[model samples]
Target: MKDVYLFSGFLGSGKTSMLTDVIRQLKEKNLKPAVMMNELGKLPFDSQVVEKDIPLKEMLEGCICCSGAEKTEAQIQSLLLDSNFDVLIIETTGAAHPVEALDAVYSPLFADQLNVKGIVTVVDTKLWLHRQTLTPQVRSLFMEQIRHAHLLLANKMDLLTEAEQGQAVYELQGLNPHAFILQTTNGRVPLNLLEDLKATAQVAKKEIIKAPLSAMQLGSCLVEFTGKEFTQEQFEEWVRTLPDTVYRMKGYVPIEGIKNPMLFQYAYGMVQWLPEYLKMPAKLVMIGENIDTVPVIGFN
Candidate 1:
């Protein structure tokens, strides 16, 4: 098993900028590292900005925790089988929930090959208050990312007044009483502070990560159904009727006589699907206001 670190944070929380720094720091010590980036509806163009030559995997168009679990697992397997990287870092979508994503990683299939190193959550102090003021659905989604994090990184400290910084730290501690709080100007934290390394017991000297991961990205409720297969027409109709609150929905579902699990993505007020993957059983994760209240497909 190799060391695995998961970076959990909301959108615009500096996960990408921090990843570049972490990769360089890891290479400075001669460690082989790989990166997995999750983005919404597109490839992580940010990968183009990474100066390092590390191997990168893109789990695009959906959150790994809910609808994209299988794709994510497949990518992870490919990385471990094809590459010689000693460390794996997964940067989740900002809206993704950390709990479900972790479950997919620690599942029996990969448990023997991968070890849990840490769950590092980076937060932007400048936007934290603004996000908090959004609807409860949005707020839950935002707070969920930090609630169960091992470390609550209060990034962008330079933008806040001393009193504001103290208040921000207080809020984080109030949510996750056990997390280690450190203020950062731009996601500038030591990689050593991330997780314990078994190859080097000396690295275990610090105990920063301990909190467990929890369910993911907010404003969404996950809906998965496998009892019956769907006709192509039925599937399309179901997607079209999705309520307005369904901001994003994606997952795999079995199709009648198709023999392939259909992969569907709905975001930006449009829908797209690929029949090639055909990884089915219809697992959908919907992120938006009142996902539980949406009566589109009636999963409740």
Candidate 2:
């Protein structure tokens, strides 16, 4: 059986950057590994960065829950059959619920083939306080990601002061007393934190939090596209048209003339782009609650 590590965090928490570094460290230790990325958007930026050296696969279009439990199990089985990797690393989307992601991995189909070694939850020190002020749905997502993690990586520590860092750690501890909390910069926790971890003797059951009626009233629609090329300007215009209700959008796109694919990330109304070479075919995934895909694709 292969060891599986789940890496999860909220938007801009540096999960990818940290995972990339971890892969490099694993290589130095002579460990063969494979990565699975659950990207919210069409582009696979995280996958591209690691694919150059490690075998990488991606699950796009929605969160692990959106794919339903069975499909995720099949995907894991297929990846194991296709590769000789000793470890499997899954990077969940920023808005993902880690508990749900974990539950999916424990599905009967993958239980015998994959062993979950640990969960490393990356926390953005700078955003932790502010996130509490957001809607309950958003807050729940962030908390659930940290709650059951075996290693709570309080990342982006450089952004916080000594007092702020201490307070953040304190709060995280309150949320998950069993997790080993560590301060890190850019998601750089030591590799030993995961090196020898074995899945809990029995998979720990996860607590399910039902969305309140008001929260359930808000819904999201996800659309995915796979193609060879996209115009940079058009992509920007298309994303700009997203409605306010569209809380997050992420993915990668290979620009027509640019040498590297562009990573697109949007949260609330903030947007960021990172340009890098494409290690796989071009794809885009968009997530918008109560929004239509017509304008999103039309812009491209």
Instruction: Kindly report which residue pairs in candidate 2 clash with one another.
Output: 41-250, 41-285, 42-283, 42-284, 42-285, 43-252, 220-289
lDDT of 2 at 275: 77
Poorly placed runs, candidate 2 (over 4 Å):
202-300
> What is the lDDT for 29 in model 2?
87
Worst 10 residues of 2 by lDDT: 207-216
Count backbone overlaps in model 2: 7
lDDT (10s digit) by residue, model 1, range 1-300: 678888889888898888888888898899988988888867668777655578888877788887787788788888888888988989888888776665445432344466656568899888886775678886787787787576778999999899999999998888877567779977887877775322111111112121122321123334545456777677778767766745565666567787766776676478787885534445555544334445644332
- Please estimate how well model 1 matches the true structure, expressed as its whole-model Cα lDDT: 0.68
The C-alpha RMSD in Å for every predicted model, in order, reads: 10.4, 14.9
* Model 1: lDDT of residue 46: 70
Q: TM-score for every candidate vs. truth?
A: 0.65, 0.65
Best by lDDT: 1
